[model samples]
Target chain A: MKKYKILANEIIEFIIEKNLKRGYKLPKVNEFQQTFGYGKSTVLQALTLLDQQGIIYKVQGSGVFVRRNPGDLKEYVALTENLGFYSNNQNVKTRVLKLEELRLPPKWAVEKGLPASPCYSVKRIRIKEDGPFVIEHSYYSQQSVPYLSREIVEGSIFSYIRQALGKDIRFSEKYMHVVKLTDEQAEFLQLEENDPALEIKEVFSLSDGQIFDVSRLVYNYKNSKFFSQSSDEILS
Target chain B: MKKYKILANEIIEFIIEKNLKRGYKLPKVNEFQQTFGYGKSTVLQALTLLDQQGIIYKVQGSGVFVRRNPGDLKEYVALTENLGFYSNNQNVKTRVLKLEELRLPPKWAVEKGLPASPCYSVKRIRIKEDGPFVIEHSYYSQQSVPYLSREIVEGSIFSYIRQALGKDIRFSEKYMHVVKLTDEQAEFLQLEENDPALEIKEVFSLSDGQIFDVSRLVYNYKNSKFFSQSSDEILS
Candidate 1:
């Protein structure tokens, strides 16, 4: 068991020694195991740990690659396409909070860069996969999304917006920050007071530059992760 | 002072009562003071408080309004946008870790859904408006972004990429969760041992469906707030 960890560290050391660049592919897992004379499970465990450390990444059909420099503390993701689709088959538990139609005042208009219009508001909790992931609050412009109803919002709001309102979310500007969980947040997420969480704020804009929506996403960080790919300078 | 709070609450109440949606302009500051028989300072203080609560927003030349809700807590931008950009500008400070190009292993490739190719990586700490906003670690495909150097990463990595690589960021798929701060993370962010913080994982993709970047953004949420907007049904 210890040998496998040593082997994994050795692999990392080799990469560092060679000054290998990012995206450099590694040998096959079978080969690695064979070379190290380690069991598949041992190799897998070590690899998994390294992945968690943001050291390496695995490509499905392909092999693995060195992801970052040695002693790098930043987190990285290898894949980031085909997202934003909701699954109807999966059963996700939810708890609803405030839901209503709200008119935009000057304050909101300025924030959203909208021309001061009426909007809809919805707040809910979502639980899926490992645990409760996030508390979501959403707002929509009434003029843009006419005839929004409680029933429509009951299912997948993203689907409804796409199907009924014909709104296509092209891009979003996102801001991530850390926040101490409030009593309500902690209770809802089933954590103690002051448990840290990630707060994701985004503004969705259409391809034509119209600000369509804005939202705040709060998540439990212990069981979650984020992924992305960018140039070295961008990452710096 | 009590009257000021009352007047501010009254303004919010009026918006809700009248169903004034987002972007609905409020009366002028002078008008508010006259109507409520309050001093300008009092009225301004109340407005400022409301603004801070995100109950209202303001435009420089335009008046204030009740804030319109934007949907998708994970994608909302109102709170941070108003706070100001987290920049490495004069007011912001940055602590650079190590910067270098390195090869990613198969584990990272699989996570990124890549083909186990060579890649470049950079790591750094971003500090400016507040405490450490994020410790960024990034990985890039060498095939796409060649000629990346450590010197280039010391400044704004995003700017370097756009200027040097001509790569434009179109969208990103993000994952977020909460975690207790590790001794290292806590020390770096200047928090107590085991302080809770928000962790965000993301995969940034380009317009042509190319996976370009991945990052994990951690935020210190001790004194901060996070919010998201989504349809009510998603809560279920």
Candidate 2:
């Protein structure tokens, strides 16, 4: 990481540690220089980076102030990562609606990279404190996963895949569509049919480049927010 | 880039070059190995990557076949990238609705990183051959932009900023929300009031870390699809 980015992260930690609220004045640049022992330019760059990210703001001739508290904003689902319900939601629980072992993987599953052999198909509703936030229909290749149980499904399957099975998920490809909820989906999310929602189809590959999982996630339109940040490398 | 990724890109180019149609059979793995002079494993890896991305599908005994032709699927607005309508739409044109200079920037604009001095505010409706696709409300810091014109706004402002002003846009941060369109927004998008849409708020920074632009975009609910892809590094 760049020196300025390291300092920016430290500043964020300090803000969280001090429980700074919005509009609370921060220490001056020289004051931070004395504390962190960084040069003036480095400190300024760090602050500028933070300001650009909406973490803090500067007033002319005045010192910096907090724009928002850390964690005050709603968490956004990073589009590039695998779906992990545990990381974002508090007091979350899973209700497994269906878990079946298929003798011959369905045509859709095969097209999604599941082999023609046996596999596990799961339908789950992820509930937060307020209500069901997502409905997921997932297919796991038995060739790679080899095992599935209701107890594991209720918890974190990704964790089980990593810790218990010793598999590392390397990357994911996702396609998203803006869709209206069907009656069954609406009933699952406790929303009305025809309500707009986001449907994400995802494929997961393991470290060895083995495609082992495919999932379709439908998020509750009212409760979900997504965020993305891109650098020059991503520009067309 | 890795050798396999390079090969995958080459394969994509080959697909386009051959004008491969849906269900058209591609050259066998050996043929690709002969053409690219890569090892069998490398060729397989490239094919696997393409399969994971929904570009091709392999039959058990039959050779690989094209699942969809190049550009067959509707283009998805990559969540991590800026809103570049030109890249995705055909015959896209911009209709400048409002453009003016503000002596004292709005409070919301200031909060979004525009300096308190003079700036340009613009409202534009982007139309495609079908109809209006997006409505954008944007604020550009006069300190960075320096000047603006209706002719420029009717074209690509970002292109003008890069090509004419020689200012490099280094990065952007985006926040997305699922929203119901207001009556005014509905009229602009030619949709009914309360229609679901994606609202994206974005802040763009220059190479030197100056936040020069902030924009709010409302995408037509019926015509928009967004995509995101992440690696292990982006996992929470």
Top-lDDT candidate index: 2
Q: Write the per-residue lDDT of candidate 2 for residues B1-236, one digit (tens) a residue.
A: 78988998898878877879655888999999999999999999988767644466666687787654546444666664554656556577899999999776467656755543578998999987678888999888888999999999999999899899998776676777777789999999999887778888887876655678888999986777676655332232
Using DockQ, give the best candidate's number.
Answer: 2
Tens-digit lDDT string for candidate 1 (B114-148): 42357666667766455765566777666666666
Interface RMSD of each: 12.3, 6.5
Candidate DockQ values, in order, are 0.12, 0.30
When only chain A is evaluated, what TM-score does every model earn? 0.59, 0.70
| Candidate 1 chain B, run of 10 with poorest lDDT | B227-236
Q: Provide chain B TM-scores across all predictions.
A: 0.57, 0.69
